[model samples]
Target: MARGKTQMRRIENATSRQVTFFKRRNGLLKKAFELSVLCDAEVAVLIFSTRGKLYEFSSKSIKETIERYKRHKKDIQAKNPPVEQNKQHLQQEMASLMENIEHLESSKRKLSGEDLGSCTTEELLELEQQLERSISSIRTRKIQVFRQHVEQLKEKGTALAVENAMLRNKLSLQQERGSNKEKATVPSADISEVSDVETDLFIGPPETSRKRAL
Candidate 1:
């Protein structure tokens, strides 16, 4: 059967932990040296113990390796610049925006008659004039709207009156027609009178009839 894998955890015994540290440090140094020699590369390693003991490895002078590493980092950073300049620009823009906002807020407050203790006579007069102009403009707009509303109401009233008159006329005409129809449907009495002359037996003789006719 395969052996179980060793669990990677801290050594409970202080002596064992120190021994493990020494062994790992030696192994790491040996690997660093081999990598630098075989690959012809610069290498550096630094390690510190819990008790403040220092351990290090460098293919060349440790100072030279540190300086070279710093230069390489600087080159990489130069290749892709940081956003410090952009951040500064954004901060300046934000500050300017905030200043404008504050200025607008102060102006609004002053217009509302708040914080007026610092106003000079000229400023007060100017503000009053501005308010007058604004009120005049508002009143003018309101008057125009009211006039328009009145005109609309007048038009609606006129239209309603005309409709009412037409309805009344139609009703009157319908009643008149109905009355005429009823009159036509009823019968009327004849008012002719008879003559009052007498027609007695006058068939005696042509001479008598002629005398009577005369």
Candidate 2:
């Protein structure tokens, strides 16, 4: 009959677990020894029992193996240089960010008009000068914007004046072309009435225009 497969699980009983650990440790040490002798390969194994007992097997000095492992790790790290550079860059960025945050906090306190009680007279004067310069800059910008707006209004006014002159010239040309015919077809009083209506429609009184502008 074939033997049943052993279930892979923790042995529940303390005595059973201890026995298993002892057997497995011995088996592992024997395997390491055989592997080193038969294959002529370096081998190292380490095990720690639940009771804090240590078991180890090494084809050569364990210290030599550990040092080799450490050197191998360093070689791998040296081969990948970007990892260390990126780590240092990230550290520098974090430090810079922290410094920027502190500066911003200090500026915020100054802007809020706080933490000035301990300031020296020279520092206070410097802060006052900075504020004055800022206000002057703001006022200069405001004046520039106002001038731009006025210039835009003047451009629009010039365009309107040119359009009005063109319209007047067109009206005069039409009037000159039809003057004789209009006189023959209409009475003098009716001509005057039409002229008054045209004037009122095309050209409002100057005082009214001025009031509206204001």
Candidate 3:
């Protein structure tokens, strides 16, 4: 004879509930082991009971599997090099160039300050030419730096504008969602749950009932 099916309600007796939990847990673990063995597959299972007990199973060393997954991820990232590595390399080169440029400018300032007024007219003219050339070079570099700064500011401004638009859209969406949820949770206008509450507070009751209650 077939046993009767259990009802879909919480078990009233503690003993029966415990027995059921034990039987089911063992059956589930057995099935998982059988699946791993039959399919020759790696599997990990973690179970937590209502009593705060933990159960775990793994077809392979869990740590080894996780490490293998990380290795695969690293390999995939290594395959794509142009955009990331090239950008980083270019940035590093630019920074080094800027540093060397600052050092050279400092040295030039020191050289300009050294006294050469007692020198010959020919030497003076040569020095003047050198000074002009240095000034021209400095002016060119300043222009380049200014242009780069302007371009960077423009890029930053554009990014900020995009971010602000996204935030505004997100805020608008959140407000709309909140309004919809409020409407759903509220009772219908026809139902009027608060109408009686308002009346009880403001309206005078029958005189006889009031006197009797008092």
Candidate 4:
């Protein structure tokens, strides 16, 4: 036969309640003593009777044990702060970050020439000076970039000039060689390609030509 399971609830009869409390309280005290003695553990227990009686047990002096417990609890709490404290800290940090963001946004708006209606004369002057400084820096950078470009162009121009000179020298040499070949082949036909005529015909300015024509 299965034994009936005892329900774990208050015994309604006053005499039964007192008896149960006395029995359980002594059992708990005995367990605490055994745990401390057998396991080398610091144990404490507290029980209250219905008639306002206190039953307490501790491996050492109860005051000292409680103080030690308080110290250990403090150390544990210090190592791992409560969730509420961490939450509050995060909230404060977020608030500070939001404030900084707002300040930066306001500054950006001011710099962009927006939200100027609330600015004082002194603030506006400061902004103007800041803008002037910024513009000066931009102009300096532009000049620097322009000078670099100019230097690059000058280098390219020099390179082109040197190339042109080399080409001219080569062309001159080729022309001399061609002329010598032509002279050896046909001395009578010593014809050469020239850009200008070397005659005594002085072709002056257009006005002089017109005068001479007149």
All candidates' TM-scores?
0.49, 0.53, 0.37, 0.62
Error of 3 at 63 (Å): 87
What lDDT would each prediction earn against the true structure? 0.90, 0.87, 0.82, 0.90
lDDT of 4 by residue, 1-214 (tens): 9989868987899998888778878898999999999999998887777778888999988898889989999999999999999999999999999999999999899999999999999999999999999999999999999999999999999999999999999999999999999779774444554424444455778778667656
Please list the residue runs of candidate 3 whose C-alpha ends up more than 4 Å from where it truly belongs after superposition: 1-118, 186-214
How many clashes (backbone N, Cα, C below 3 Å) per candidate? Answer: 0, 0, 0, 0
Residue-level lDDT of model 3, residues 155-185, one tens digit each, is: 9999999999999999999999999999987
Model 1 quality (TM-score): 0.49
Better of 2 and 4 by lDDT: 4
Tens-place lDDT per residue, model 2, 1-214, is 9999879998899998888888888988999999999999989998887778888889998999999999998998788767779899999999999999998898678766898888789878888888899999999999999999999999999999999999999999999879978777778767677673322332588888657556
Q: How does candidate 3 fare on TM-score?
A: 0.37
Give the clash total for candidate 1.
Answer: 0
Decreasing lDDT order of the candidates: 1, 4, 2, 3
Cα RMSD (angstroms) for every candidate in the order listed: 10.2, 18.3, 39.0, 16.4
- Where model 1 places Cα greater than 4 Å from the true spot, the runs are 1-14, 22-47, 50-115, 188-214
